[model samples]
Each structure stands twice: as structure tokens, then as C-alpha cells.
Target: MPLLHIENLTHSFGATRALVGIDLKVERGEIVALMGANGAGKSTLVKILSGVLTADGGTIALKERPFAPKTPHEAAGAGIATVHQSTDIVGVPGLTVADALLLHRIAEHRTSLFVSRSGLRREAKALIDAAGFSLPLDRDFGELAAAERQLVAIARALADKADLLILDEPTASLSSEESQRLFDILRRLRAQGIAVLYISHRTADLQAIADRALVMRGGRIVASFSRPIDFSSAIQSMIGRRLDAVRPDARPVGNPVLEIRNGQLAATSVPFDLTVKQGEVVAITGPIGAGKSRLLSAIFGVGRFACGEMFLDGRPYRPRSPAEAIAAGVSMAAEDRHRSSLMPAGWPGHSLAATISLPHLTKWYRKGFLFGNRERREANRAISRFGIKASDPLASVWSLSGGNQQKAVIARWEAEPSRLLLLDEPFQGVDVGARREIVEAIRVRTDRATLIATSDPEEAYEVADRILTIDRHALLPTAADPTTNLAITGT
Candidate 1:
């Protein structure tokens, strides 16, 4: 019998049907890849399987026995474990790694109240040893990098003895080497007869790890591919369209919009000089914690550095805050969309137009009242400019598909004219179709400078006119690319 079996699974959120008559099965030790663009019902299906949501109809059988879980705890007890994209935020930031790993046991009173701190550390260390991974039990969970936090979440799942593992974009924030290590671990798990349902937008990951592939669109299983998966066909089926395999040609360049001289990312880092000109998109590539995001943060006026001289449009420039940066003709889209960007649907003034106009509300609303229809007009203009999938500017942004939501965010910054625009990991949690749309939209403008920071080298090449690399907090010249014939220079 299959390890997991689903029949006629259906679910809905208010008026929108999220899942419809879904049928699936996973045999022991099988790895299944779930491919879908945002709002394709992948999250909804995972939620049902993880016990975050109960299916309105259908039946699930695990090990040929009927299974239904009412809560996340119930799901884990039934051998289902999930590592969400943002699993880093699951534990208290102040807790030590050992305590963070033991949080569930403590919550369920599975551990003795009298256990000492050393005991917890020993227990956590043992779990890590048994799982064949390394982690610092005494480190504060908050201080761990994104990759470390993700590993911690995975370790916690293993500790639960879960027979079925669900991973959602597990390598989104990891370096290529780190990603390979994760794949190795998954293979080991499969050898142990654990079934895995892997979710990701990265075709490389799907190819490396998936034994079978399933595409979901509009709340239904649209297509499924077996071994020797036709990835190109699978992607087309996921987005319901063929993508232009070519990167858009670069726009013409002008004088520099942003220039940095004698800039130091860290106190001990190499001093560097950098320039980004109007109509040019420059990407800085690095691993996590390599200080690429730090450069963006400093330019966006959210982070500070010990030494640097910046010039904007041929004038000495320094911004003390984000508002100051915006006023000086600079706009930034942060890496974490849900945390740093986005006015979610339920909040007051959370319409698509409102989200676009939020940062400039002082000039639009002024004090307590909205002045006129200008906000809506700009919102509509952005919507059209980016080919956003939304027809109404007044609708909740959360209702749009995943790719469209990112388009909305990019549009939010693009609505106002700026000399420089910054995007930090702008492609997070988005699929290839949406990514290409954003790349096209971001490059179409020839009047401003665009600086992109990404850890993915392929993504850097796809969107940028030039690519730079950072190592040990030092900005380094990119090796000459034969395809582009560009000599990138830096420190």
C-alpha cells in the first residue's frame, strides 16, 4: 500500500475554491515535487496535509489507515512534519538553539520541568548527532543565519520521527553548496523509507531531487510527469503559458545615478568603488551573510557603515533614514516581502492602490483625509505598466496570484519616479514566469538606475547588465563572461 493516499480532496476559502477533487498517492521512500505559481493552491494543499486546515471533503489514508488531523500538533503526532519557507521565525528569537529545538516537548510537557539547561543541550546535541548534522546548541536562535534557522527547523522535524516530510521552497535562501547538502540529507531520508513532498520554483532543484513531478493550477492538478521529467513542459503547465527563454536586451545607459567611493562594507573589509548608471541594472551576488544585502541596506538608509562617500546625480549624498532616501529620489524593495514590505489584505487601507500609495500618503492624504483620485490613478498606471494581473486597483492585493503580488510590490516603488531603484532578493518565493515579468518591467525604464542584490548567480546574469561579487565583505570584480563580453571591475 502507498504510504499516503488522498481521494477527492476539496477545500475552499470563502468564495474561492482552493483545492478541487485532488487525488494523489506517495509510496514509501518516494520524493514528489509539487510545482505551482503562487495562488495555485499549493499552500492550501500543504496546509491541509500539515493540519493547519481541515479539508472540507475527501479522505486521507496513511499506511492504509484513515487519518484526519484537527491541529498541527495532531498532524505531527500522526507522522506529518513540514518546514515552511519562513520556518526561521517559528521559535522565540531569544531562546538558545537547544531550547528552540525542544520547544514542542516543553509546550507539550513531554520533558520534565526540573530538567537543567545542560540536560536540554545534551538532549539537543544527541538529536543532532543522531540526525548526522551539526549545530551549536548554545547559540541563540535569533542570531542564526537564515540557512542555519532552516536547518534547525529540519532537525526538529526529524526529531519528531515524521514518516512524511513536506518542504516548501527549502533552498530559497540557501547557497548552491548549502542546497546540495540539503539534497544529500533528503536522499538519506528517502533511504530510510520517509516520503517527501518537495515544493520549489527552482527547476534545478526539481531535477536534482524529484522522482515525480505534479503541476497545480487554479486549485486542480493540471499535469503530472514521471521519471525523466519534462521540466520545460511542466513549467509551461504550471503557469499556463510559454515563457520567452531569452533575457530582454539591455536599455541604453547614461551618466551615473549612484556612485560610491572609498566605501567599506565592514571595518576590516576592502575599500571599494562602485557605480550604477541610469538605464543600467547591476547585480551584486554573494552567499548568505556575505554583505550583499548590507550594501542595499546602507544605500536604502536602513543600515550604517563605518566609512563611505556616496554621490547621487553628481552631488554628495547621505540619507539618515528611509524617508530621507525616498525624498532624495531613491526607492527600495526589501528582501522579506511579508515582513519588510506589503500591506496585507486585512489591514486598514490594504487595497492594491492603497499599498502603492502608502509610502507617499503624507502628500496624498495629508493629515487625516484623502484628497482626490490621484492615488487610484497612479495605482492603475503602475498596474498597467507592470502588466499586473489585477483589473481593479481597489481590490485586496493579497487576492492576486503570487507573481502578481510581487509585481504589485515592484509597482509600488515604480509608481513614483526616482533616480535610483533598489531590489533586494526581489524574486523570493516567486516562480519563473513572475520572475521574467519583473525582470522585463524593471529593465524597461531607461531614466533611472537599478541595483539588484541576489545570491543566485544565474538570476544575476538574467537581470543585470553587469554582475559583481562580494566575499568576506569585499566587493570583487566579476570574471569576464564570454557571452556578454563585459569586464566588470571593483575592488
Candidate 2:
């Protein structure tokens, strides 16, 4: 019998039908890849399976027995574990990895007997080893890098005695190396007869470890494939259209729009010089923690450089904060939508209109005041242009799926004009189609100098006029021959 089985799953949010008649199965020792476009009901199905939400009409079975959990803890106790895109699963900010790894045990022991710290550390170390992770047990869980924190969450799940594991976009924030390590761990789990449900937008990941693939469209399972999958066919099934190459529209480059000279990202790091011309798109690529973000932060006024000079259109520009950056015709779409970008409690329109800091959007007598109709009009226009899937403009930003949420964040930045645009990992959780649309929109506009910071070289190749690498906290050209770094054919 399969480890997990679902039949006729249907769910809705008010008038919006999120999922409709979904059926799926995952057998032990099998790894299944779930592919879908934004708002295709993938997140809704996952939530239903993990007990975060209940299905309107459906039946679920584990080991051929009826199963319906009322809460996440109930689901975990029943041997189902889900790792969501957001790291909020490991909720305690100050908890150590050792403690997090043994959280289940600690929670189970409702006795006065205290557990030994050394003994717990040894146990946690054993669990980490078993999961093929090298995370430091002594480090605070929240303080670790996003990838490390994700690994810690997975380790904790494994330690809790999981039989069916669900991972949602696990590599969205991880570096390539970290993702590979995670793949290795998943393979080990599969060998041990653990059922795995891997969800991702990355075709490369599906190619690497999926034993089978299932494509979801409009909240229904539209296609499935066995091993040796044809990824192009799978992607086509998910989006209901032919996949196209994501190349930015070619445009002319003009005079320099921004320049940085002797900018020190870190106190002890060497200074770097860079220039971006109008109508040019420059991509900076590097591994995580390699200063890609530092460069972007410095430019956007989120972080200060130790010593340097920045000029915007031949004028001295040093922004002390993000507001100042915006005031000076600089727009930045920050990474980590959940933390820095999305307005969790605000409506979608509110989130989209937040980026335009113009007095017209805020002043009472102006046309774009929040209480007036301008913000709503802009939000509607952005939703149509960016392909955001919110049914109502007043719907909370937190209600959208992760990929759709990412689109909303990027749309906010692109809605208004700016001299320079900074996008950091804008494609983190975005689907290929939406990513292509966003890149095309930004590149085709050719109204500003856009700087994109990403860890994926393929993204750089697709959208950038110039590609630079961050090494030892400094930026340098990837190759002397600029043509060699140009977009690939078909792009």
C-alpha cells in the first residue's frame, strides 16, 4: 500500500475556488515532484495534507487507514511532516539547534524530571548525522543562514519520526551546494522507505532527484510521468502553454546612470568600482554569504559602505535609509518576501501601492491618496500586468501563494518610475512563466538602470547585459570577453 493517499480533494476560500477534485498517492521509497504555476492550488493542497487547512470534500488515508488531522502537531504525530517555504515552522527565535532537534521529546515529557543538556547534545548530534546535515547544534536556530535554518527544520522533522515528508520549495533560498546536500539527504531517506513529496519551481532540481513527476493546473492533477521524465513536457503541462526562453528584450544602452568608486562592503574588505548605464541591466552573481546582498544593500541605502562615493546621474548620492533611496529615484525589491518585502497583514492593493512614495500617493489633496481611487487603479493595473492571481484587490497579501506573493512584491517596485532599480533574487519562488514576464517587462521598458543580484548564473545569462561575480566581498567581471557572458541563444 502507498504511504499516503488522497481522493477527491476540494477546497475553496469564500467565492474563490482554490482546489478542485485532486487525487494523489505517494508510495514508500518513492520521491514525487509536484509542479504547478502560481495559484494553481498547490499550496492549498499541501496545507490540507499538513492539517493547516481542511478539505471541503475529500478523503485521506495513511497506510490504508483513514486519517484526518486537526492540527500540524496532530499530523506530525500521525507520521506526516511538511516543511513549508517560510522558516516559521521553527518558530522560537532563541532556540538552539540542539533543542530544536529534540523538541518533540521535550514536548512529550510533561514530567518534572529535567533532561541532561550534554545528553541532549549527543542525541541531537546523532540525529543531525543521520540526516546528513552538518549544522552546529550550539548555534541559535534563527541566527543561522536561511539554508542552514531550513536544514535544521528538516532534521527536526526527521527526528520527530516522519514516514511521509513534504518539502515545499526547499531550495528557494539555498545555494546550489546546499541544495545538492539536501538532495543527497532526500535520496538517503527514500532508500530507507520514507515517502517524499518534493515541490519546487526549479527544473534542475526535478531533473536531479524526482522518481516521478505530477503536474497540477487549476487545482487539479493534469499530468504525471514515470522515471526518466521529459521536463519540457512537464512544464508545458503545468502552465498549459509552450515554455519560452526567458531572454530580456534587447535595448540600447545610454550614458552612465550610476557609479560607485572605492566602495567597501565590509570593514576589512577591499574597495570595488562599478558603473551602470541607463537602459542597462547588470547582474551580480555569487554564492550565498559572498557579498552579493551587501552590494545591493549599499546601493539601496539599507546598509552603509565603510568608505566610498556614489553618484547618480553625475550627482552625489548617499542615502541613509530605504526611504531616502526611494526619494532619490531608487527602487529596491528586497529578498525574503516574508520578512522584508510583503505586507503580511495588508491588502494586495496596499502592498502594491506601498512602493510609490510620491506625494501624489500619500497627500490628501493629490490624486493617489490611499483613501482615494488611485491606489486601487494602480493595484488593478499591476495585477493585470504582472499576472498576479488575487481575486480581490482587498484580499490580504498573506492569502496568496508564495510564488504569487513574490510577484506582488516585484510588481510594487515596477509600478512606478525610478532612476535605478535593484532586484535581489526576484525569482526566488517565482514560476518560470512569471519570471520570464517580469524580466521581459523590466528589460523592455528600458527606462532605468536595473541591477539584479542572484545566485543563479543562468538568470544572469538570461537578463543581464554585463555579468559580474562577487568574490571575497568585491565585484569583478566574470570574463574579460564581455560577449562570452552574453545571453545564450534562444534567449
lDDT of each prediction vs. the true structure?
Answer: 0.84, 0.80
Superposition TM-score, candidate 1 onto the true structure:
0.92
- List model 1 lDDT by residue over 195-239, tens digit each: 999999988998999999999988899999998999999999998
What TM-score does each of the candidates earn? 0.92, 0.91
lDDT string for model 2 (1-491, tens) is 88898999899999888889999999999999999988889999888888899889989999899988888888888898998888765745688888877776677773224768888889889988987778889988777766677777787777666899999888877888888988998898899899889998888998999999999999899999998998899989988899766555456789888899888888899788888889999888889888888788889998888888999999999999988888889988777767676644654334444433222344333553356356566668877887777876655677877766777777666666789999998888777777777777778767789999898887787778777888778886554544454632210
Clashes of 1: 0
Give candidate 2 regions above 4 Å deviation: 96-113, 116-124, 136-142, 346-372, 480-491
Clashes of each: 0, 0
Task: Name the candidate that leads on TM-score.
Answer: 1
Superposed model 1: Cα runs more than 4 Å off? 128-140, 343-353, 370-402, 484-491
Clashing pairs for model 1 are: none
